[model samples]
Target: MKEIKTKIIERIKSHFQDAVERDYDYNRLDFSVKKETIPSILFYLKDEMNFKHLSHITCVDWLEEKEFEVVFILWSYTDRLQVYVRTRIDRDHPVLDNIDMIWRQANTYERELKEMYGINFTGLEAPEEFLLEDWEGPPPMRRDFDTREYAARTYYTRPGREDAQDVRETIIKRTGEELPDFAKKYKR
Candidate 1:
């Protein structure tokens, strides 16, 4: 454990000059860096180090701080190791430079974030509609998109057992068992 920690710290320091903080939890290491340093850090990890696989790119909407943070999870196939790169951006005009230069496949994830989270990835080939076709209002993934209100307004929910016939009441009456809650309530 001690050796792994020492090696991971040494590796990050040796490989990435701009890594601001090293955080570890859930059996994975996280590297936080300035958004501007992303291109350099990604280049170093992809080309120099063995972080050849980009598992996924995700975002955390920190509404309280009014910033959206992006995370890129990278994997080393050879060492079976993983690392995360995280950066924060202002929420008012949440925009980020595309990581397509480092990982061309990052475009797909970026597009999803653009559609779902409304975080504009400047210069990416974003189409008009992707996840939600013709979304009329605020992006659903943002902290402000009130899901309950949205569902009440736009979503159609199928009536469930609450909307069922009084089958339970009928069964209770036929069997002469203690009246079911539904039957008791209906009697009142």
Candidate 2:
């Protein structure tokens, strides 16, 4: 494991000078690189380094920093290794190259990110609406999106069901079970 990790680190550093490698967990490594180098690095890892599996792709909105961190998780079945390719893009203009060509499943993840985070994936060929249906609002997954406020404005109570029910109280009534003192704080 150590030898493979060392070789991967050395190869990535030699090929992509801007890549910064770190070992934060057992059998896992993180490579932070410039957003522009994402496609090339992913291609290299998949084609050359035997990291053939694209496990997941996720995004983190850094509202304070005005950036969005995109992470591509890859797995190597043969080596039993996990690698996270991370990059940050400007929040104001969150545009990134579409890597669906490298992995077909990437199209689904990219489409979700495009709709949820407002991150534009240039050249991505997919439906405009991925998860959300008939939605006309700011990206719901973004950190700055106020879910409570949105719910208040968008949802309304029925006349017969106007009162909100407390789940904990309802459960206690049905089961005759008293919650612990510490858990009582979570009561509605």
Candidate 3:
């Protein structure tokens, strides 16, 4: 496994030069590449290196850095290895080249990313809302999204039960034992 990973790293380094940053963890190899070269690198991995499976696509919102990290997980059945292809794009204008043509299943993942992270995949066909319905305001998956505030403003909360009491107070009163910090949040 390590030999195959080393070979792949060496090949990518020789071919793409400084355009990629490589990291190895046990049996997984992670490559951070520029958005522009994503398609080409993925093509090389799929066609030449036999990384035929497109496992998933995920996004991470780095609010402090003002960037979005897009990850493409790939797997090679023959080599029994997993590779993570990652890229960072500007959070304000998160646009990426579409790889749906290379991997058919990528369209669904891309669509989800678009709906959840506000990422636009250039040249990819826009699908209807994947998981959200009539969603207003910013994307819900973003770090800046205040879900609690949104729910409080958008939905009505039922009144607490008449029997409800602070669990901490109840525990202290009954057994003379104060509830731990973790148990203090719940109502009895």
Candidate 4:
């Protein structure tokens, strides 16, 4: 696995002229490429390197960096390897070339990205609302989105909610067993 990943990184570095920043860990190779070069790089990997399966597309809003990181996970059946092709685009104008022609399933992930992150895929058809209906504000997935504030504004909560106690704390006081970190975040 390590040898294959090393070879793939070497091939990309040689062909793409140091266009990618390579990272390997946990048996996966991640290649961070430029937004403009991602489509061609992915096409080459798919056609020549046998990375045929488009596993999924993930988007990360880096509010501090003022950019959005888009990752395309690809799987190779023959090599039994996974490659993550990542690129960063301006958060304000997040647009990229659509790869729906390369992989049909891309539309689903692309549409989700569009709906969640306000990313626009130039060549893809305009996507309808996926999860949010008549959403009028900033993309909820962005870091700047204050979910607690949004919930308070969008939904009607009972009065005196500010004095609510943590449900996990009450449970721990009774049971003498601590709740997991995730459970501790919610209040009664």
In terms of lDDT, the best-performing candidate is: 2
Model 1 per-residue lDDT at 162: 46
> What is the Cα-based TM-score of model 4?
0.83
Off by over 4 Å in 4: 159-188
**Cα lDDT computed for each candidate against the true fold:** 0.80, 0.92, 0.86, 0.86
TM-score of each: 0.76, 0.84, 0.84, 0.83
Query: Which 10 residues in a row give candidate 1 its minimum summed lDDT?
Result: 161-170
lDDT by residue for model 3 (1-188), tens: 77777798989888776456566477788888888889999999999999999999999888999999999999999998889989999999999999999999999999899988999999989757778999888888998999878977998856773334455575577899856787755644
Q: The CA-based lDDT of model 2 is what?
A: 0.92
Count clashing residue pairs per candidate.
0, 0, 0, 0
Model 3 error, position 145 (Å):
0.8
Model 1, stretches more than 4 Å misplaced?
1-5, 14-18, 23-27, 156-188
Winner on lDDT (1 vs 4): 4
The parts of candidate 2 lying over 4 Å away from their true place are 157-188
Candidate 1 lDDT, 64-156, residue by residue in tens:
999999999998876666788899889999888878877888988998998889888878886668778877888889988998679868877
**Residue 74 error, candidate 4, Å:** 0.8
Mind giving the per-residue lDDT tens digits that candidate 4 earns over 71-132?
Answer: 99999998888889889999999999999999999999999899889899998885568778
Model 1, TM vs. native: 0.76
Residue lDDT tens for model 2, 1-188: 99989988999999999999999788999999999999999999999999999999999999999999999999999889999999999999999999999999999999999989999999989865779999899999998899877986899845654234566676787899888898777765
Two-way TM-score contest, 3 vs 4, winner: 3
